[model samples]
Target: METLIVLDLDETLLYAVQNKLERDEDFKMGSYFIYKRPYLDHFLTLLARDFKLAIWSSADDVYVKQLVERIKPAHITFEFVWGRSRTTKKRKSVTDDYYFVKRLSKIKQKGFKLERTLIIDDTAEKSMLNYGNAVQVAEFTGDPVDDELLQLSNYLQTLKDAENVRIIEKRFWRNG
Candidate 1:
C-alpha cells in the first residue's frame, strides 16, 4: 500500500491573508488573498507519484473544498479533502486558547494504518496527540521566494519506502 500523506492547508501548503503581500496573489477567495507556496505544483506532482495524498485543514469546510479545487492540479486526485468540521477542537494548556486538531485516529477509522500515515503541518500544538506521525514544517506566510516545498519533497522521498513511518525521527527531518 502507498503511504498516506495528510497535508495541512493554512500555513503548510498555502498561506491565505486578508491583506495582500508585495508579491502577486495566486487567487482571491471571499475577503482573503491566496498565495501558493513556492514550488507547490511541482511538489504535489512529484509526491503524487509515490504516495497517496489527502487534505485535512482547520479552515472552514466550504472554503477548504473550494480552495483545494482551485489549487489542485487537474491530473492529481486526493484520497480525501476534509475541513474543520472533521477535526477535534481542543484547548491549549499554556494559552488557554481553543484550536483544531487533526487526530490520526480519524484516519485509522477510515482504514489507513498509522504505521504508514504521515501528517505534514506547521503547528505542533494541532498534532500533539500524534507526534510520531507528524512532520513539522516551517510556517509559510506568503514568502514568494521560500523553498521549503522543494526541500520537503526531497526529505519525504527518503521515507517513501519505510515500513513504519511512526518510528522515524522526523523532528530533525530538515537536517536529514
Candidate 2:
C-alpha cells in the first residue's frame, strides 16, 4: 500500500536564511538562500519509491513554490502542494507571532487515508490535530553531519506495508 507523506519545508527539510552574508552553502530561491539538510536528494528518492509525497508549509505560496522548484528534480515532485493559506490560524500564546496549525483533517477530506498518512514536521505542536499520525524530528539547520533523514528512511522502509502508520510511528519514532 502506498502511504501519503506530508512534509514541512522549513526546519524539517531545509533552513531558509534571508541574509546572504550568513549563507555559505546557499541554495538560491529568489531573495533567500536555503540550506538543504544532508542527504536530502537520497532521502527523497527513497521515499518516492514507497509513498506519495506532498509539501505542506506555513510559508507563503510564492516562496514555497520557488523552494519546491529549486529542490525537486525530474524523478521527485510533490503529489500536491499546500501553503500558508491552507493552515489554520491560531492566536499567539507568548509572542506577537501567531501559530499556523496543519490540519491533517483537510488532507483526509481530500481522500488521503488517515491510517496510511504520515506527517513529518520538526515542531511537535504542528501535529496537534493528528498526533497519532505524526513522526516528529529535531529541526534541521544546515548540519553537514546530520544523518536524521538517513535514519528515518531506514525506519520508514520497515513500515512500507504497515496497515496503520500510527502504531509503527509510536513504536519506533516516539520521543527521543
Candidate 3:
C-alpha cells in the first residue's frame, strides 16, 4: 500500500492573507488573498504518483473546502479533505492558549498504518501529539522565490518506499 500523506493548507501549501503582498496575489477568496506556494502543482503531481494524499487544515470547514476546490489539480484526488471541525482543541500548558491539533489516531481508525503515515505541517503545535509522523516545513507567507515544496518533494522521494516512516529522522529533512 502507498504511504498516506496528510497535508496542511494555510502555510504548508499556500499563504492566505487579508492584506496583499508586494507581488500580485494568485487568487482571492472573500476578503483574503491566497498565494500558491512555488511549484505547488508540480509537487502535488509528483507525490500523487507515489502516495495517497489528503488535506487536513485547522481553518474553517467551509473555507477549507472552498480553498481545496480552488487549488487542487483536477487530476489529483485526495483521500479526504478535512478542516477545523476534525481537529481536537487543546490548551497550551505554558501560555494557556487554545489551539487545534490533528491527531493521527483518527487516520489510524480509518485503517491507515501509523508507521506509513505522514503529516506535513508548518506549525509544530498542531502536530505535537505525533512528532514521529510529522514533517515540519517552513511557514509560507507569499515569498515569490520560495522553493520549500521543491526541496520537500526531493526529500519525500527518499521515503516513499520506507518500511516504517515513523522510525526515520525527519527533523533534519531539509538536509536529507
Candidate 4:
C-alpha cells in the first residue's frame, strides 16, 4: 500500500499576505494566500521520497490545484486530490481530523488499510485529535509572514524518519 500525506492550505501551508488578499475583493482577482514559511518545496520533495503527496483542502480541487501551481511549477504534482467535499471551519475546541478522511479514502480506494497516511494541518480538530496519521500544527491566523514557517522544514523532515504509524503517535501525539 502507498503511504499518503494530505496537506492543508490557508494558514497551515500558506500565509495571507499583500493585505489585499485578506480582504474579500482580492480573492476575486485571484490573489490568494502566500507562503510565510520556508523549506516548502524542500520538505515536500523530501517527503515524496517515502510517501505519495496528495492534497486535501476544503477550497475545491480546481482552486487547490491552481494554488499549488503557483508553487509546484513542474517538479511536483499531487497523486490524487480531494477538494470537492463540503467542509466548514470548526470551532477551535473541536477535535476531529478524520472529517475529510472518508472523502480522501474514497478517492484512493485501496489505501485505507495502510495506516501510513498523514494529515498535516494547523488545527487540532482538523487532525481529528491525531487519528490516522494526522499531525496538527498550532494555528496561524494573524498574518502571512509568521515565524513558524522557518521551522516547518525541520519538522516534516523528522516526520519522514518516523515511518511507522505508531512512531508518529509516540513522537508527535504525545500528551501535551
Instruction: Report, for all candidates in order, the number of backbone clashes.
Output: 0, 0, 0, 3
Assess candidate 2 and give its lDDT.
0.83
lDDT measured at residue 137 in model 4 versus the true structure, 0 to 100 = 67
Scored by lDDT, model 4 comes in at 0.57
- State the TM-score for model 4: 0.65
How far out, in Å, is residue 90 in model 3?
0.7
Residue 8, model 1: lDDT of 95
Clashing pairs in 3: none
Task: List the pairs of residues colliding in candidate 1.
Answer: none
Model 2 bad stretches (over 4 Å)? 20-23, 93-96, 169-176
Choose 1 or 2, whichever is better by lDDT: 1
Better candidate by lDDT, 2 or 3: 3
lDDT over C-alpha atoms for residue 10 of model 3: 98
Q: Whose TM-score is higher: candidate 3's or candidate 4's?
A: 3
- Alpha-carbon error at 149 in model 3, in Å? 0.3
Candidate 4 stretches with Cα past 4 Å from truth are 17-33, 84-104, 107-114, 141-163, 170-176
Which tens-of-lDDT digit does each residue in 41-132 have in candidate 3?
99999999999999999999999999999999999999999999999999889998999999999997788998999999999999989988
Q: Looking at candidate 4, what is the lDDT of residue 3?
A: 60
What TM-score number comes out for model 1?
A: 0.97
Best first by lDDT, ranked: 3, 1, 2, 4
Please give, for residues 1-176, the per-residue lDDT of candidate 4 as tens digits. 55667778756766555554443321222554354344466667766776677777766668776766665636677876656463444443455433443233454364453356677777555556346566766566554445454465455555554446635453354232
| Cα error of candidate 3 at position 74, Å | 0.4
User: What does each candidate score in C-alpha RMSD?
Assistant: 0.9, 2.2, 0.8, 5.5
Expressed as tens digits, the lDDT of each residue in 45-155 for candidate 1 is 999999999999999999999999999999999999999999999887989999998888988878999999999999998888888899999999998899999999999
